[model samples]
Target: MSFLGLIGCDNGRNIRSICKNNPEICADLHKDSWCLAEKTKIIQNRYAVKDSEVTTGKQLYIQLTDLEDYSRCIELASGVQHIIHTERTADRARAFRLSTENLSVLQEQTRERQDPFMSYYQWTRFGDTDALNRFLELENTGEVSDPFLLAQAATYYSNRNAIKAQQLYLKVFAEIPFDDFDVNWLLGLASTYRQTQQFDKTYMLTKANLLLTQQKYSEQKMLALLGGNKLLAAELDLKAQTLIDSLEDASYPLSLVKIWLESQAVAADIKPETLPVHSDEK
Candidate 1:
């Protein structure tokens, strides 16, 4: 059967429904072969594909972001060499609108300036694991000088790749410093250090972060970090024992560590109320 004939014969109703709901799909069929391929998948998968072609920079921008396939999105983005600098002001405006709209479609109503990093940032924030991983590769290779990007990359890698995440966090901390930096990144870096068995660094960073911000710290996680540090534990073992002793009921990690320390009670020589509670302690 012919293409249009086959639509009516078997999948015609499905195609009709998609085309009716998304006129852009119909519009792109004549202009963009890639758009047609994506639209065909929507038909075959019974998922909705966006309308529009890739004739102008604006259309290309929409097409890039509209696709769920990360590789295709990157391919489409690469096809448009300089989308922000399109000769037509309307094209440039449309590109900016599409990119920023993806960031926050409802709240960011104001037409903001074209951000070169917006697409990458959006991919990093909202994309699936594969997309995030791909974006991480791009982030590693690119000259990502922006502190926000570095922090975001670090956060994304915080669980997946502790070494890379710690390195990125250290870079962010060193460049921006705590007094002017995002507290979340500091805590994240501390957590990364904790995960990688860098107890001293974790304690130092966590203590510094507590001093900088009044945000709640997880007592269990902190105690676990301190408990693993032989140097700190040797000097402050009595202090930790005293803190738990003062508390009527302690939580898991703290309780667990306290129990273990109690088993070593003779060796610990625990002191009473010796641990210094900080202003930030919960």
Candidate 2:
């Protein structure tokens, strides 16, 4: 796809220049772009369901007629990220349910800086309809000004209600520094911006993430490159994989990078086949 087709922007020059100097960024962009391309193909398949019956917290709560059995399943998949990236609605629902249940237990055990909206998330996830209504009734009556609480509340509404989520994220963004170096909230806000068609904001946040990541690991990446130009590509690829694995949901940022880099790669004259061809193959 063309640059405009992928990210609907003219930031190609900036992307190309930055990525050329930063092979780690280039490698990461390539991986994410490929994954996103595959995801798009999967999404275009007819067998993929148009709407997940139980994808949302509310829907899962209602569909899990046997709460105990489903809850057990949720417990098992508690740490799985990218729940929404699945092609299967059932899988997505299961992951969401597990996350909510896990959070519920963790909230009870810890007495530290607790997210004020823990009850809200827990009740919504398990489909405790009556309880959720009661909690919302009490919680919504007052204005929530706590930065941590507002961010958590925003996350609760994320994906389920995009507009509301965007609003909450915007508020939180104002409170947080631009150079926070924290991935969680920044990424969340960027997703909301993209969903809301705020492409400029999305591009800015995505670029910031790239710059932050590059700066953070510049020393290590440079050392690998200096070892030998011959091993640089392989070394960068390994580092990218390690970084992707460390993320809660690598695909999210990867998708963003893929979109921007699709065009950037072209502008920089970067061919898709970055690896050195084998002598036998050649």
Candidate 3:
């Protein structure tokens, strides 16, 4: 066999096909009867490394997260006794056992890794302050650009440093639009406005969330934040729709909404106002 002949060979990267061709990749995992989504993601991550001679730091991070998810899902799956074939339960139990050890080993290996995303993982998962410091340093240099990571950073700062949290979350909105956005952040942003007594903005952010997710976020209390000023709340509702429109079309960074969010931080110390003042919150 000529060594040159190996260069033209191609292997499918599909998770199911990869699992079918490489038994050991998924041998320790539970069968399709349980945790299918989690197992698929884990197998996909694993398959990405099959041909690479060395996995990158990002790969290790993703593997760690995937294993954590699979372990958690399978742990729950293992407890649900099968009504028909109890062997299914046994399979999940074995997978849970293996996954627990695998996650622990990976966590230990990356506990001190200094990369930004991995540092975030360590800080959030293990409460490692040293890792958190590294992550914050990277964040300060604007290295943490991923929307999801920025959201996590914003949430971490929300309780400790209000100003930093506001800035980080502003970056999140700058980079992301309404499509597929996490609505929980809206509640956080809304509360921030309530603290500053910018009731109109609080209503805008909250209403935007309700528009997207229709989640039950206690509208009555939100009205109370506005001092029962339904007239003001009703006017701000249109602003909320405008914010959603901008976010929906990915025009938020240049839209008035972005300007408003930035402008409000400067005016945070201004007197409390419940009337329809269109400054910003999130």
Deviation in Å, model 2, residue 243 alpha carbon: 23
After TM-score superposition, what is the CA distance of residue 228 in candidate 3 from its true location, in Å? 4.3
Ranking by TM-score: 3, 1, 2
The local distance difference test score of model 1 is: 0.48
- Per-residue lDDT tens digits of candidate 1, residues 77-149? 4355455654433433343444344435422321231232443534544454544555566677765666666
TM per prediction: 0.39, 0.31, 0.78
Tens digits of lDDT, candidate 3, 144-222: 8878788888888777776677777888888875665787887677666666566567677878877777555555566
Local distance difference test values of all predictions, in order: 0.48, 0.42, 0.75
In candidate 1, position 125 carries an lDDT of 44
Poorly placed runs, candidate 1 (over 4 Å): 1-116, 124-134, 177-180, 215-224, 228-282
Best-matching candidate per TM-score: 3
Model 2 pairs whose backbones collide:
none
Worst 10 residues of 2 by lDDT: 269-278
Better of 1 and 3 by lDDT: 3
The best candidate by lDDT is 3
